[model samples]
Target: MRGDTSPADGDKLGREAPIPRQLQQVQDDDLDPDSVKRHEEDDDDDDDADEGRDEEVAGLVPRLSDEEERSARRARNEGGAKLGRATTTYREGDDDYDDEDHLNHVEDGGGSRSPFADRREQRARRRKPAGVLATIWAIAREALPTLAISVLSLVFSGELLIHLARWPVFVKVDKLFILVPILLNLKGNLEGNLSLRMSTSANIGELDIRRTRETLIFGNLALLQVQALIVSLFAGILASVLGVIGGLGGASEGPKTAQRRGFGALLTKRRVIHHHPAPSDPSMRLRNSYFEFVLVIATGMLAASMSSAILGSFMCALVVVTRQLGGNPDNIASPLAGSLGDLLTLTILGLLGSFLVRFEGTILATLILLALAAACACCFFLAYRNAYVRELLSSGWIPLVVAMFISSGAGLVLDAFVQRYEGFALLVPVATGLPGACSAIFVSRISTALHSGKGVSSSLSHSSSSTLISALRDILKLGPTEGWIVPATLFTIGAGIEVLFLVLVWVTGQMSFGWPFAITFVITSGLIVAASLYISHLITLFLWSRDYDPDIYCLPYVTSLIDVIGQILLVVAFATATVLGDQITAAVNDHQKP
Candidate 1:
């Protein structure tokens, strides 16, 4: 087959696969661009636009055979390049940068247009500004429904937290508040990262073969199990550390505070304000208990491991199905993974924790924790044995740890202002999650484009200087012509969702904010999502240029950053509503007079 090398050739090359016939032909002066287009056309007959992009990149960007595709992923420090005809040169000096022409840069090519070139003469003409508009409209038409469903699902997670907060498991369990949000944040990152990576793997033809598909899917699933366990353990430790701080006199608040949201507290006869439910026996300091510490770890590990297993498999299958159904998984997978991860992880933590709390000091709890450790170790061994995910065992830890620290800092912001306004906690998901969902989608698309080997064969594919150039264009350039179409469409949808969230809260009487605060909420959330989309673009470029896997690097930090930013924006929206919302202030005053 001209598509991939034979099994014997793959063995002879060790880990690297051979270049395709069209790519090798690029070295010959007799190479015909039209012929290359024909081969690709037969391979992807349904996609008319990608034909041009394939022809364009074949003459420009060079790809490696690698140790990981046939074995595509190589070691982090290893630069295993086998250029066919074109050459790439990265310049640090500003002089080499084409300030005027974003797409033309350091390339020794066989007369191929860079995948990222904003060359209006060739591409922009066919896609008139109207075509660009239509392009984004098509993207929006498919994507908005998925984004909406994902965002709506977060309400269940938020509601779960609200309902589960008052459970005795939370009271008896030390720092469950501190533990749950961190686990959810970390787990969300893991699942979203899995979705993004799977989408990239699938689009690049990595999963086209049954053998390769099995390796990638199973290896990644094993890898997820390991990551989830480690991250869960980290969550338990952070909660303990924060609980220690609370004991020594700093306040620790988390998703549990969401339970006390709304102004109903203002009208209630008794003033009952506490970070978590007070124990019936005031003498017991739950935070200091040895058993509580072990249970916290147990609960987090159990919940995170189970959630990752469920969400990771679901993400893999979903991406595969989306690809099979002739849809881009990039449009749907990542956001849904994030939303479902949070909801599933939280629910498991709450319900399982309640059951486990009954066995806290017993041998049963200890046995369960040990068994989980053994199970995670088994998954780690499975991950290490697989060529596709072997390296992941060592990679991606720093980002996860860093994200935890960030989300932990966000706890301070949440603790300070969560009780200050009505429906603040209820709205946290839609506010923060909408932007995060947008960023995950953006990051996944950039990652797929950046690593798809075929250059920007589709809107989902990028290369070095060209990659950065296109990232800027794709994220920033707008209007009827060029890059603005997809981004603007996503932002438009995000803005609509943001406004809808506020309306839902207000109409349901869960919150009372006047025009001023409603306006503030819309403006603030809009900016946050805009910033999130742009930041995802930047982070993906940064990681990619460094030769690090952007799939692992991009999604985690963006989601965590959104957590902090979303909560701060919520507080700002609330502060605005409390001060400038005459309707709210009047209601509070009226209620107080009675």
Candidate 2:
């Protein structure tokens, strides 16, 4: 019956398009208590029929046309007379659509309504469910840009040109093939850790803090870093022994030695899967601080030993500096603190990484990386067993963070061994494979296990899904809210596209060549950083407009994309630029002959 009405004059759609405020006028007004008391005493069959009619009236939209107005009034009258009431007391008034009036109501200039009240009501309307199919469809549609970016990156990275130019270099470096994958894994791991921490923080009330939480997170990172270094040290020793044995066997020692050296050199790397301990509650939050610190110390020692005996002391000093500096309360502030701190931290870390890359070997690097990884695993398991930590950090961030840290640590260790023994530069590719595959596998398994009827109650799982679906259905049934998801969704898509392009450049062999590689790297890096900022800005903006859950769901996916691209870039960079001399020589020779 409500659907039969046509749009009224001065109304955009139907009746006067009530600007939300007018719809709640009844609730705001005082009710006649004596009239309500008398209606509660009625018990006639006619009263029951009138009650049904009154229920129907309640279903009608509060904003009405003259037609709806008469119908509701008639319904109320019939319902009331059956209860022996004199008449139903009601009033109908038209709200003039005035910008000034709306502004005043919203600004507190008019005490009639608080600005937040109408906005809250609108949000409640928006959050109602649209349905399962709609929700799934929306999610899938939203992911299209992400999928497109992946495809594009795979296609257009311009790597063929670089590969063709640097064949000999590829030949020379082919033995250390594990390097690319290792780097990508590290990047993803680190980013994933950050996301996990963010998500976990969001779940608790600690997402925004000035000091305590930041110190803990920084300490954890340092610990993880140190543990990685320690692991690399052990790996390097093993690699050296194998290299020495192979050299003595009289094989092409050039390749063997190179493999060992390269393996050791690639120690100071960015891992794809990094873990960030989320501060869920005070206890686990506090515990992670100490745990992460321990991990960093262990990793640092391992990596230093493995990578370079020459710079071992320097590397240790760097770790100590990082640990001490990172622990400073001022160094690690709330996420919103000055970019100066982050810039400083980045500079210090980058310097250390550069130093390590210049002198470190793959075998040593891998050992330290693995050692740190083991520490991360131990920390996670220990905390998981404890109820307090589990409760605190057990949100969307933990799974991804844990998966990334452990996988990255494992990848680095394996990469070191691979480089030392195999002379295959598998870094970029392996980074894409190991952490991506393993994390996805782990997530899938966990989701399945949790959803399966054997362990958990089937009814509970079903109920939860059903509730979500129902909520979505209700949301869809309500008209759309102010178009906030539009811009947010667009930003997500744009970032995802940029990510794919970055990956493409890395994969297409642009990363290996001299100038082209450099250009590609800059472009890719800028896009990633920009995209992240844009997403954060848009999400925050949308949240102000409507209640949108900024969860870790997108973080892993984004980090994975970044990791893949970063590793691909590193591999291409090394592979393409190695033959720069040859290219220049050939060009010069041709020019001279002409």
Q: What digit string (tens of lDDT, one per residue) describes model 2 on residues 156-222?
A: 2223322322343222222122222232233333333333333233222121222223333443344
Write model 1 residue lDDT over 283-363, tens digit each, in one string: 254446777788888889988888888888888888877766657788889879888788888888888888987776667
Tell me the whole-model lDDT of each prediction, alpha carbons only: 0.67, 0.33
**Number of backbone-clashing residue pairs for each candidate, in the order shown:** 12, 101
- Kindly give the stretch of ten consecutive residues in candidate 2 with the minimal lDDT sum: 328-337
Stretches off by above 4 angstroms in model 1 are 1-130, 248-250, 253-287, 453-482, 576-581, 585-594
Alpha-carbon runs more than 4 Å astray in model 2: 1-122, 130-194, 203-594
Instruction: Please give the lDDT score at residue 214 for candidate 2.
Output: 37
Prediction 2 TM-score vs. true: 0.29
